[model samples]
Target: MANTMTSYTDAQIMKALLTKDFSGIGREFVDDVITSVKVGAFTGAQNLDKVSLPSVKEVHYCAFQNAAITTLDLPWGELEAIGFSAFAGASGLPQNPVFSKLTALSNGAFAGTSDKKNTDLRTISLPLWTGSSFSEGSGFSNSTGGIFAYCTALTSVSAPELQSLPTQMLYYCQALEEVVFPKVSTVNSGAFNYCSNLKKIDLGGAITRLGSAFMANASKVTALILRGVTTVPTLGSTTFNSTAVKSGNCYVYVPKALEATFKVASNWSTYASQIRAIEDYPDICGS
Candidate 1:
């Protein structure tokens, strides 16, 4: 199936989207990598090299569920949101969902946070994605763990705009080594559950809440940095029970001025001995 030139109008794209039929869009290219192409509503069967959606504001659910395009050119300047499962499947997209342009995502466009469960034939399903790496996912404010959950190959995350971590955000991503959330204040339930390789977290002063099992099974984390937080943030049950403590050296960093406050703050008292003041160490997030 070689697609030479059958340009589709925006109306045709929407029509194909509404009807879920993409016969009008010339299907497939032998190279499987496009230099530059513009259109929408790709049937999961097509192989594309590049896709550029310039005028699109919203990508409805499952629009490009399984197109084998190697490049994704989302209309970052104009796109507002992407519905759930908009790009599901292990190979649906060539890269991770690190939207480098979601600063304009003002209306809370979640981008269809997909899981590993959907069995629809429209999207290609496979085992774990081993090549995925984590970067600063920009332009998104989703509060669901579906963003990068279950990616066995994910190693690090550096989301500067994230103020809160959604439930099960990185659940079971055992390869995670570092997480840098400069502004994250809230951590929902099961946020980092079962991530065995996570070594450190630098939660700058803005943190306020830690939900249950947020770091449930992350056993190798040796450091937890909260050097900027003055007040003891709220803690849920077993926040770091089997996860960090299993390493026997999980150090919790806090401001020296308020070290006493964190030591006795309800559930925090459980790790009172592990708490240390950030003022005492310059290279804290690592140690």
Candidate 2:
């Protein structure tokens, strides 16, 4: 039964949300004060497998942290932000959930693992993303987790318009295998940390700088395609120190004319043995 007695105190509202009963809560009340889902409102709502999100613009902290949400009619264009741990423990979301116009995602916004899986690029979009790292420049610090950390089912991602990747963007996504960022110029620190299955990175012509620990502990990365990058990226001693790229086991495929340049560049020179002209890998990276 809907709690029809409308006037509610702070404690009463908390009790109503905790009980998972919002039936008779009139739309007027919802639109005026509950525009956003209250924090921790549905944290463990196991029966909440589908969400009706048309009236909601934002989801507050831990609102549905561990809910059984498998489907939602989310207004992607109108939804602006999702709070920290909003869907952290929900393991039933689709592998390719579209975020058409979303602008902000707090730490661990969708952190937990899920059973739904796939390799879809448009699953997450950031054409309107304007948030910066909460732990900016402090690459490996655990202070801020990525929007999709520990998402084991997500296998791939491609953000063609993104220029810079924040720290730990896809940290510990064990199933992630490929990344396509044609216009990305700077991949920040620890962006792909511990992604064990990651093998291909197509930075194309735009990448200029790779931050500290950019691909740390990503041992499966065997293909680094910089098709038109004429200038070697700024590489420090530990830029790729912990990845397969630094150990001479992977191939750094660059434009044919710049093969020599990469082989002789600063830290890149150290991997001269692994540097190769893109033309030679026509079967793998195309001509």
- For candidate 2, list the clashing residue pairs, or say none: none
Quote model 1's TM-score: 0.69
| Per-residue alpha-carbon lDDT of candidate 2 for residues 1-287, written as tens digits (9 for 90 to 100) | 12233454555445546675433332212223345776787777644445554556777677777765456445656666777777777644555655665666667777755453222222565565544322212332223357677777577564555666767878888887888777666677888898899998777645777789988899999998887576888888888788998776788898888889888889888889999988988987855
What TM-score, computed on C-alpha atoms, does each candidate reach? 0.69, 0.73
- Residue range 153-263, candidate 1, lDDT tens digits: 665555666666667767766667888776677777887787788888787646777788788788888888885575778886666667765345788888788898888
Candidate 1, position 108, lDDT: 14
- Compared with the true structure, model 2 gives a TM-score of 0.73
What C-alpha lDDT does candidate 1 achieve relative to the native structure?
0.56
Off by over 4 Å in 2: 1-14, 18-35, 38-50, 67-73, 76-78, 113-145, 228-230
Question: Cα lDDT of all candidates, in order?
Answer: 0.56, 0.67
Predicted model with the maximum TM-score = 2
